[model samples]
Target: MSGRIDLGLLVAALTAALALSPAAAAPQAGVMDARAQIAAAPSATITNGLITATVLLPEGDKAFYRGTRFDRSGVVSALAYKDRQFYGPWFDRISGEVRDFAYDGDDIVAGPNTAMVGPADEFDFDTPPGWAEAAPGGVFVKIGVGVLRRPDDAKYSPFRTYDLVEPGRRTVKIGKDAVTFTHTLAEPTTGYGYVYAKTLRLPKGQPRLLIAHSLRNTGTKPIVTTVYNHNFLTFGGAALGEGLSITTPFQITSGRPPSAEAAAIRGRSIAYLKTLRDKDRVSSSIEGFGTTAADNSATVHDDGLRAGVTFHGDHPLSKMQLWSIRSVVAVEPFITLVVPPGQEAHWTYAYDYAAA
Candidate 1:
């Protein structure tokens, strides 16, 4: 067996000065396995032998800007939102209504038609006259323009977009005999007044099992942002015979609080998130009850027949986000319910695969 410290140093050296395709960058970390491969910039395969997992990196070096660690205890991943592009309206906005502030899945542009967001605009909240209602658009544009983009900066407001960067590359390191893969972003990008981002990848080598991780910065200035991990999984036309069960530290709120409308979704309806269809998509909440006083941790997972999946959060993260893709569940942990600035410490999430 290889020493832990030695393995880390060796992988770091090989990925230190590496750059690959902008659509899907794969650094020759080790070997490849047969799960699936897509023509994306930041994706990984075993360069030599068979491994249990593969790492998928997003282009534009935006995947790994958040950190450099991979998943071994399980599949590890992070959620990255660059610049003021994703922040929505809060406080005030006369011309821009709440609908313009919420996030619509259309603009995400992750794949041919896949989006981190659902069909409807999520996160649209109601507020007083000064604090306008958010429908769902671009968070950064809503926050930046509705509040910051006053007549003073209205001119430059039109130029802001969430497209982080054109694209980037990704690399992966397959550990020996262990279900671990390390992914690193090739470069970073600038947006929302911030100049940092890395490529992130989600590699699933086993049936109904997957892992992911990312590195990112909220920006040098304070910007209200919400980091949500949206996962998309499936059962290949399988029925919910055993049904889907989720466990989290938070007590799970019944409905959205008085402050947010979009979050005003009912948890009881979607708690078990069985089968998801295009029309069955909507925004909801997964309230945490363990500890909300300050930054804390939360763990969540689903019990799958013959197996199960678990996700955990470590330091730097405080909240979790859940979205459904067809039959897949998007699990996201956040630093703050609403990220302002300089709030990032160290955060984590895990995907544990075990027998049912």
Candidate 2:
């Protein structure tokens, strides 16, 4: 492959599952009653009692996700551990049809704007600095989203939602288990800016959840980019093809392999042979990992709720891949963000949970 892998790891190889299948335990059985039935936005909830999480605060039209394609600063959601529930809400609403997701009738919409859900993190995801030579009233730069407006180019679709012009300086604290998000921008007429920060901890007793990041290169060009963590692993809402699976130490070879009836990479694991119906998918391009960071940690199992979670990274992996559709299963991992202007770059990810 050429990309993917990065979800969060370390729970002694957690594996002891089952329990949580009410559409994935209905947002941990009442996360403010499913955020008041999805859409009141402004969220924050962290529990150290045993891994309980939720973070989504950008509130504009109740920003659950306003689509610009990820990195809406720490926008996590329903991530239970013991009671079993890992990541939730995998598209079923929010559409405009710009580049990615779309369904309409039965729900599931994520296009033109509304690119959402957990582990959401992206930057310069395929052309974001002027989106294909900006023209049409020019302007571009999407480091945690801000300063966009390249309306009409026909190409440059991170699920199109452009036309913000400026959406920087955002902040959110909320602690008790941890939650911090920051964003800043300058954009000297397209020099690219940043200050980005993201945090989401829960380490009290330790079921695990730690995702820290930093980026500082404050404007004036020189922020070569690449930031990944789309690991939408949805054990909650579990149902993405036969009991789910994905375990990797490094041996996934994929020259675009995906769809051997669904999934099956073998060697280091990537099973799941059937269950993703209707618009089904299982993308690939996850080559053999090497070059450090413990060959890149990864683990995800479900054997029908016999839960598992492990995805760690302290930097090194520059790309890895795996995508699963039918309610999520992303193994995305890519990290490389050279800073220059002012310089500063950091990466961290950890997640470990299990169930019995």
Candidate 3:
């Protein structure tokens, strides 16, 4: 017990915690009834045609797990974690308990542990009610350029400058019968924050998608930022070595070799996409994106297939971390955004998906 959190130990701790904690409310059960939804569901049951194999994040207002049939059967699909508890109280106030979300059978895969799934923060663009997980202000927004170095001083303070410019939630139309739920900000979390997500209803629907925007302040006073998304994808019943295909046109900026644990979690993640060029597939016609005041943009044509995602943020290199459990992939996007107490920054990324 070195005190450092390891996956196995963390899993056990989470299990025990959930096993002992009595549910504040009864588990909701129904096919399409919103009122019959719940935060935690037993992994022993089934949803639609999939089986609920594993339960992740059993300790908070949210608990995420997988459906039957997909690869990595019974895995975590969504949850939240923070480096500190100072903000826990605030988060507990505005955020709602997690709900059951089914996935669309076409195009992409999904998994447990996807951040910001289900509904938007009840407070919408309002500052968090309190610091529950990552202090009050530390909301996964990493710092530094190229190298990620969280600010030393104001690490997890409250988000004093954070404000909600936009108050209503809107669904973005994506292909036929496909839409994403999002909340736009006038005074966004960083510079301009757009969270694109959805709540899955059954087997023929799509899981939620979240794309957070933040900015970084360079020493030259040049405002640099990046756009990142913590997309949790699952391919239920699919194996890791099946040569999962990803098509994209953006440049592969880096290659993050998988950790030994990552290799164990899922084999494909062992060869993650550090940079765009490293991808096994690509589009010759598509190039880069146009420049905007906040960040750059790139276009990725899937050729009617499920391709990789790309973004332009304030940071130099757009980074993505691949986490997996056999059939699912969490392509977490991130950039250097300086929210160092007094400094201000922001960035954005536009994302889309297609079925291969």
Candidate 4:
């Protein structure tokens, strides 16, 4: 008899068992009488049974500033499910040194900053002349929508920036099952005319949070861009060490395999190779995805806390990346879309938390 267990086969067997289990036979019931409120500070909070989420109002707290004086809105700081918080300060804080730059004959300078999440369209910045010579203190601001040259173009690059400022929000109740926080950005800034809206919802009884977003190109130009959710997840203050596993529906292919000393991949999952010490890091850009949104789901299980979170995208994934350090773990999912003039693009994401 063999004493060693084959992890890959074990996972396969367990997956088969789950599919046949009675618990998977029907949909679970959801919570009831869920409600969302806006505090005096203008922050928004949604509470339903054991699930609660606080979305920091851009006007109230300066914690998640994007390091830019212009377009100082449209960022949400913290989201929590019980004791587990999904977002936090960036791993690297910006240096305090301030430098000056000239944009459209106006002087621009770096502003007070902190880490941000879910900012979009990262690859559309114009490297200003002498930008490399300036002091490195400004935080990277990479959220917007626009059209640009495709990857294969070699001669010209159309790197445009947009200012989708802080949105206006309202709360709405839908039937008896869920409450939604709807945020809208209607006015165009920085030459982009578009209608952008994001809704955050908490359903009754279900241990999940839903985020739905829509973008309409009201301008005369077509909007060709990619958007991603930069999920900065901190598992209830649990350290990023051993007993952490990331599971995907499909095989993973990265530029380099997880370090043998840090993590291992078995079947369709990746688990920590060993407990990571302080300052230890693991980062990678992963591929190997199918053609459907169901193929783009992943789960992060924290064995130490006996809890986990599953992230799902309702749109086909264009790319995926992962980054982790001592403090936080980020799983980024990218989606590509094109909105012709007078057309719109839409997508949804859901986060479900569980505990053993």
TM-score to true structure, per model: 0.44, 0.32, 0.31, 0.65
Give a tens-digit lDDT track for model 2, residues 41-87: 65656667788786666644445565566676787767887787778
Candidate 2: residue 165 lDDT (0-100): 59
> Candidate 3 — what's its lDDT?
0.26
Candidate with more favorable, higher TM-score: 3 or 4: 4
Global local distance difference test of model 4 = 0.50
Q: Per TM-score, what order, best first?
A: 4, 1, 2, 3
Question: Order the candidates by lDDT, highest first — what do you get?
Answer: 2, 4, 1, 3
Q: Which structure among the candidates has the greatest lDDT?
A: 2
How many collisions per candidate? 68, 23, 56, 7
Model 2 residue 215 CA deviation in Å? 5.4
For residues 1-356, write the lDDT of model 1, one tens digit per residue.
11111222245224422343344212212111112112222333321121123233332233321111111112222111111011111111111112112223421112111212211111112111111222233222222111221222222222222222222223333442222322222211213232222222233343222223232323443434434343333322232322454455445663433223112323332245334333243344456445543323332233454434455445454454565433344444544433344453223344443443
**After superposition, which runs of candidate 3 have C-alpha atoms over 4 Å from their true positions?**
1-228, 235-241, 246-315, 339-344
lDDT by residue for model 4 over 1-356, one digit each (tens)? 11211222222213110011111011011211101111222333345556756544333222233232222233434555666665544333222332211112222222132234432223222331112222332112222321111222132222122222233332232222232333232223223356655556666778887777777766655556666665767765557768988888999877766776888767677788666555567777767888899867889888887888898988888888877766667677878878787888888888888866
Q: Which stretches of candidate 4 lie over 4 Å from their true place?
A: 1-42, 60-63, 68-83, 90-94, 97-114, 117-191
Kindly give the stretch of ten consecutive residues in candidate 3 with the minimal lDDT sum: 84-93
